[model samples]
Target: MHEIPVPPAEATAAVPRLQRLYEHRHPALSPVLAWGTDQSGVWVAVEPNEGTPLGSILSRGPLTPPAAAAIGAAVLSGVAALHEAGIALGGFGATAVRVTTNGDIRLAGHPAAAVRAAPSQSDLRADVRSCGMAVCAAFGVDPAGAPAPPNISPGLVVTMRSMASGAMGPSADRAQAALREMAAALLSPDREMAAQSELATRAGGRELPPITPFLPEGTVAPKPTAPTPAPYIAPTPRQETPVRSPVSYDAPDRPLQTYPSMPAITFPPTPVPAPAPPPPAPAAPATPAPSVPTWSDAPPRPSAPVEPEARATNPPAPPTWTPMEAPLPAPAEPSKAAEPEAPKPAPTFETAAPASPFATFPPAAPPPAEAPAPSAPPAQQTWTPVEAPVWKPGETVPAEPLGTGVAVVETPPKAPTPAPIPRAPIAAPARRPSVARPPSRRGPLSERPPWLLPAAVAVAIVILLGIFGVIVLANRGGGQVTGGVHTTPTARASTSPAASSPSPSATTKGPLAVPNFGPTSADPISKVQICTTASPCNIPGGSPENGTACDLSSCKIEVAIYFSSVQKSAQVSYTIKFFDRCTGQTTDLPGPSASTPASGYIVSIPTDHWTVSIPNGVKSGAIVAVASKPAVARSEPLLLGADSCA
Candidate 1:
């Protein structure tokens, strides 16, 4: 059971009257279960609370327009009911309302009978203002100081604010009707779903704070304390083992071997080399060329006529001529008149001169015993094998020198009985110099003109551009949605409600539900915006910024209406209305009628606008949209700045 204590000052008069009031049942109230008085004061018990408190729900976060409207509507209904019964709540706020689990609204916080009886506490207009303030509080708006939230409808915002500031006059019915309409439109399935998604995107979510009772001034609630953790205890340390020293030992002894550096070998100085002999002067042709001696230092040739050898049937090649072996020539004795020349060393293969085509040599002789060592010491020398000299045609053979103890032939060799004819050297066929020619151009990937590369690049770029154009055309012609705009390139049949309506048998059971539109989607109507000369509103491309301050002379309103899935391919007609709270007046403007294609589209209304004005003492205003045909629908109040409108 729920319980409330009656103040001591009114306990006597209130206890009896409250009993009679509770005798009957009311939809806006809970039945009084029992009544009595205890040591604290007079008390009344009612049914147990079945739902969350509006205050607790507000603690979690601000409510959406629909949610706040639902609560506000229920609050007013209860207030209106109580007024009919000639009763009034002394104090009404967020805490005084409770929403049941089954979506029913119940009034709690019943006041003392004496308090309700007082005329000062029974003003109905004041109660209506309190309801508006409660709604503003649910939206996290301070009715007296903060601007209205944008999610609310303009009409509803103006109505609520007017009621809150006592500008609604004495009629509470107007405020209640406005809230009911807002709740009906905003509570639709599609609208509710969209609101939930938007709410989820919000950052920094809040949770309800701890619920507590109101305490008298000077009294404070006690705070909770946490338990301390146990003190840390360290583990015992382990004992360390003793380290052992390394063992000492002696290494084996061995004798070391060493050698003195060897002395460099020395040799006797070589004698100065004699200059080469100059070429012999050509002899007179009359003397038969004196039989050109083979050796430069050989004895003069003999003056005898030698027989020539018979030529064979086929003479051998000139380079293949074999020379007959003859005895070596003896060395000439040193001349007494000339300085003695140093003995010449015999030629080895490495030191021998290349054989000439006109030179010849005799067979090698046996090497003689080494001559007795001279009294002077000799230099070290290297010896190598000797090679026989090559024989050539029409050349005389020369002999090698024989050392002492070997025999040498002093007499010149006699010519053979038959001398072979010598053949002249054959001349080779000469090659003509190659003729120069230009470079060949026949190959793969031949050279191209300088402009070929750039021309090919241009062609490729054109092809890419053509492909891009095709893609863009496809998107435009195929009824695709881009960004948040919908495009229809081709004409489609109109399906307005005036042209076609669903039969009764085909009608759906519930109201038309609004669907959640994606970022790239269009809703039936966009949020309203307030405009002035300083910040003129523009649509279809730009959105106007809403503000509380405006220039009255150039003030206007702007909004966009889009065809949703249910309204696609139909002609929709809508109206824009302005509610001035200060003057308690409303003005309606004819909006455009648009034929939406299958792909849907958005249209901003009232291409032309006029000045706006408000009374001197008002502080709030709103804009609202109402659509007829294709199912009647309304939008949440769009609260605008009151600086100029007021």
Candidate 2:
């Protein structure tokens, strides 16, 4: 056999153990020889003969009768051997049997032992059923392949089929019966017993080895032959009898009998035949043609009596009966036959009255006139006369003339113009006494009086002024003043009180000392700022002549005030001005006293040492020192008296 590749690690490990077990159990059979794990866990065994499996042979179609019977007998024998060894060939199928070239057959890869070891009974029976299937498949028949022999009941065949189909219950009896039936059929008289015997001999020693496991017990070989003969023959036309008035036939001597019910035969009476001398018996009773078994001319005789010898010699004939043909009636025309009449339409009613009831009412009178006549205009007007006029006290009216039979009423004529009512001119109507209005009770004014705001402002100003005056008075004596003060009076007062106190003040005095200032050095000073808030007299380089009152405090130096020396090509002059804090004015003490034209200042003092003081009254603000570099100093003023400093 060609070598199959070694399987994966797990399969490789399991193969040796399985091989050992298989070899141990099936010593008579060829060793597994070699095996390889397939994708499924099942091992593929390589045997010496390189033959196709029985399944493949059968799959090609029905086998020749000889080969089929031979293979079936061999398979049954193999299964019977396995059953004897208590090994169930689980998963058995035609595929499990292999046919060698020599025509010998062997069962391969029996699974019965494994199935028996399974925990479930269902699984065990499943294995047996599978073996039964293999037998059925090998025989090219169903699990119920043929009607079982008489000794094997039909119920047993049904049970076997059910088992093969995975129905409930153990099928040991069923499978045994089925196997026996197959074996019997194959070995029956009609079969070639010689061929089967030869095949069996060829396959005898080749049966599956006695493995460790097996199917369930009660594995019996099929009976040598059915214990009883079939009572009835298969029905056929030739076996039927001619009709002779309904009658029954009985086999008195046989163990079983069947009688067919026959219909009366009514033959048209034959013309009476003339009597003739008896004829000698014929050599053999003429056999009737299968189609025309009964003839009218045949002489009627009494039923034939059975002879003991004939009964013992011949097999019983199967009963049959002629089928009667009934004639069909003719069809009738549907149109000639009476049909149910169509239902009549329901009746409708009409009223005797006119169709429309409202047609007779008289037409409505023409719509009433919408507007009244215009003749009586006043009447048409909706307004009515006022009932009475208001009267004046003394005015008189003229009377109407005595009516001409018409009663006329007259108003009195104005009293003769009373001579210009000379009396003191009628005082103009006493001015209606001016009605006195009670003083208005409206609430206080809604908006604040304008004067009130000014008053409040004045009061606030006064309060602020008082506070300011007190602050000034208190600060005059240096009572912890905050924020720089510019007035000289305040400064002097603050200083004088501290100086004159009986106890020497702890305050430091003299040329004011600047703290936290040092010359720049290689280590790089972090920052250079002088604290001059406490002292106003000290300037880094300012001469005392500049003025003791010069207000030199809190000054910063301009390191490069004159840049000309650094720039050798030009002559320039720079002036720095200092202002007095107490005077609110500025004075240039030393710088640019006059424009001395030069390229630069060359002196030992580091230019960074030059300091400009901030004056006392100059808003107590910071002093800004600047460095100026010019191309040249002006030889003459471009505009006379135009301060170059400005």
Candidate 3:
């Protein structure tokens, strides 16, 4: 029972009529068990709700569309129930919707119309709008404003918007029908369900502050239009600069002149360079000549291309050499008198070397006297071939200059020749110095004494004996439930109604039931599942009429009540009561009496799998199972109803 605050003496006058109108059995509108006015407020007694409130849930996050739809469908049903009974619900808010532990819904804040005897059109519409606000709120919308929640499915939004607008049809029945259509739209077969489902997941996920996307108004991010292309502007013409000819002191801009070529460079034969390479036979010589050692300190640069008229020979294969006039012998070690010889103003003995034999451009002009020349390399050092690359047949091997007259040729290596001779036995030298060899690894325990095996066997025998002793001790400590339900993937529900007694014609009574509520599961969250509005109704004797309630006596319940057994012994006080399925009122099953199903030995249920057959006089209702103190956990109400559909 929660205090429903009433304002003044006038407000107190309405409490009696409110209770009279509300305290009766109804499926969706929870009946007020009792009501009384006090200085604090009007306290209305109803069944205790173990489930969370819609207001509390909304605080966590807007519910998913499916959840909102489901919750909305239920809340609307309750609201529709009230409107049908001709009472206008007042002081209602998201808090007025109660969700029970067993997933049952109830419209709780029952009050009279402002005018007492007759409800005005505006009052009915107010109730309608409240229901609409509730559904919207469940869908994560703010009902105070009129912006449609963008996160809501467009298909669902239309109906919810109309309902929230209070013009969703003049009556609660029409609003109920519209909400039903919205629920139906949530089904798989509906053409728009796919899009709605996808939208529901993201509904109201994106929110912004004032005039937020999560309000009654629709949520819609502005569509980003493609940016207009910038107008094309002709590229501005770049300034052109004239090319200046570089001044040259070594090969000048004159007619071609002949000069003696340097000798080809060679490397000393070493293992014939591993099968010495094939010559340049039928091979296209490399375009770039290996750089020759320079006499001048200037960095090497490309000289002008040599005309065919200046070449002594033009081999059909590619040119692999460049002929340049050699430097004036270096004065046999740069004699002091020769060191300062006047710098040439034009061509001289030193010609700018070309990087490739085929280059067409001449080297640029040398820097002026202000620029310092690079120091010459060490005289003692010589360049040597580091490694020889294995050459395949038809591959080129360039011939290069070594000095003024010499040249190097790469000839293919000759196949090794054999020389035959008489054979003779060679004597082996006396055994060299003795070398130690590593010892081989031995198998585990192989190197141990023979007694080691017997010791290991004795240890193993002792361990087995100790384990056997412990098993014997555990059984002696206390009794364990050996008749644990043998659960598989499915529990065979007994849907048959219970019989009064076995008929003479019936030789066997229904197989003695060892109730298996469901499959063996591993949920460490530690929750107790008693029953609820959605629990399956397995009448014990036979299948029942589909749309009608089953006999109250035929229904018995077996709950798959799992709570951590760790605290079972400490949880000493408990209450087990029946909550009427229709009225939402609880009746305590008096303890320790043969008249009732509960036994005195324990006022509380002690184990998982608590079973109870309905007593002689009790009608259809749900069971409220609670284990007090050491753990304050309650079972979802185990419902007794017509069938599983109930």
Candidate 4:
């Protein structure tokens, strides 16, 4: 495996190299396990480095001198191993090296070493020189012969210059061993601590300066003077909560809980005074006595309140009352003259005896009043005789008498007028026979000739014929009315003599009237093409192109309609259907019908493209498109390809 640092412009070329490297492996090279292309482009799976990137360390203005020496030693060690294996890295740099927290180096970035290619002299030299560059970079110095910083030891500086110049000898083992010695010397415990402290200080003083002892050993620190006492402030008293006592069921051996003392509460010695008694109720009022209903002639009296009578020591008895009844007339003495009529009793009231039948008036009002006088009976009806009708010499008299003349003529009683009675029909008297009368003479104007009827009939016929002609001519003048469309008559551009005179054959069809409109043409949809591909159906290689056939399990179907001209910007809707010839069934395309108000050219639809699945069947089917707007129009159906069953 290898790391190919392809430049931004040359990224496409790295894929081939990555593929080649996956075929071989080497210790100094990280391995690529797999590589593939996705929608996001090329990707490679390589072993991940579990170390701190050397580049990250160097990015922060280089490492300490000792750390630079350690990195240099590890890089050389890896290169020496490569040299022993007779292979060299294609390139090496800060990016190609990684250092673990434990200070071990990992080598990478050789696409060539991944394939185990033989190393060239120049390649070997380049690896060693790259190692030197890494060392110089770690020391924060230029690898182009610039003087090393004064802090780096002279021996380590010489080693950096030799490796950078590619003069470190044929084998890196010698340089690697010398670098180990320099790193150990520079990385001593005391020096390392000093370097870290210096670095931390340069990065913003995270390390504290050495602290001085509180006092010198021979002398005593002056006894800390007692801090001057702050002015006295009284502390606030805290409220103490009382502890709750334990329940009686607690273990007998347990100690009893004690509570804080509470202040005493005092109560008055005397009991509170009793509430005052309620006030007495007021006396009830006396009730008015009930009054009797009187006749209309009687005057109404004002009412007065009656005082209740004092109760007696003994229980009082209920008083008796007399119902005022009409007095009966005395009966006539018996025919024997022996029995006498019983006397009538007079009416009485609870308060007093009444002298008349109306005596029981309201006790609260006036006393009894006299009864009204009785009205006289209606006078009887009297009869006045009606005179008999005088008889004529030839008049006939009925055998029945005129309904008991006496009763019929009786005077009506003195009451409302009665309804009039319907009179019965009476027979007329017979009359003598009379002589025949002469006929009246006719006038000259009233006289009619025998030919009058036929002449009248002929005139009526002539009037009817004129009306029929007018109706026929009016109908012919209007333009023909076909399907609901209305076509107004258009004036001809120029009328030729032939157009002016109607043809003899036209006369046979109907009464010849002036023509009202010009000839018309067909519907707007002139061409329709349906196919499986999204491309124009007229184009070559489009699946089941116009007039072709289709045979597939599933396919995207698009429709293209062409029109030569439009009557208006009419809203047009399209529906596609599949006709299954095998089952004689027609199914609508499974999507919303497409509609558009645009016209005058090809209009493709559905904004969302759709596809249809052809069900397995015995044989052929047909696809049809119907435009249902502006005007109903249909396309010639196209057949599915040769029958699958066949």
All candidates' lDDT scores? 0.48, 0.38, 0.47, 0.51
- Model 4 quality (TM-score): 0.25
Error of 3 at 570 (Å): 62
Per-model clash counts, in order, read: 13, 22, 31, 0
Ranking by lDDT: 4, 1, 3, 2
Candidate 3 overall lDDT versus native? 0.47
What tens digits encode model 3's per-residue C-alpha lDDT throughout 7-41? 66745666556655555556666666666777765
* Quality of model 2 by C-alpha lDDT: 0.38
Which candidate number would show the highest lDDT if scored against the true structure? 4
Q: Give lDDT tens digits, candidate 2, residues 1-646.
A: 3333433654555554445445554422334554555764444455556345766655544333344545545554554444433344454665667766465666665532322221122333565566556544644456755654343335534544555665522223334545456455444443444334333433434322233122113222222333577698876667668776543574345543455668998989889889998656333224321121111112223255633321111222222322221121123345634554333233233234332333244334444456876653332211111111121222211122111112122335767665554566567767778889987576677546679988999999999999999888886765553334221222123444446322213352221111111122211111112222222222222221111122334444322222212222233234443323323233443332212112212211122234454444333322322223232121110011111121
- In model 2, the runs with Cα more than 4 Å from the true position are 1-31, 34-45, 48-50, 59-93, 110-120, 143-163, 166-178, 185-646
Name the runs in model 1 displaced over 4 angstroms: 1-24, 35-43, 111-115, 169-171, 182-184, 187-646
Q: RMSD for each model, in Å, please?
A: 26.6, 56.8, 28.4, 36.8
Model 4 lDDT per residue over 184-260, tens place: 76656654444444433323413223331421232211233355889999999999998866877565564445545
TM-score of 2: 0.22
**Candidate 3 — which residues are off by over 4 angstroms?**
1-24, 35-44, 111-117, 142-152, 187-646
Better of 1 and 3 by lDDT: 1
Question: Estimated TM-score per prediction?
Answer: 0.28, 0.22, 0.26, 0.25
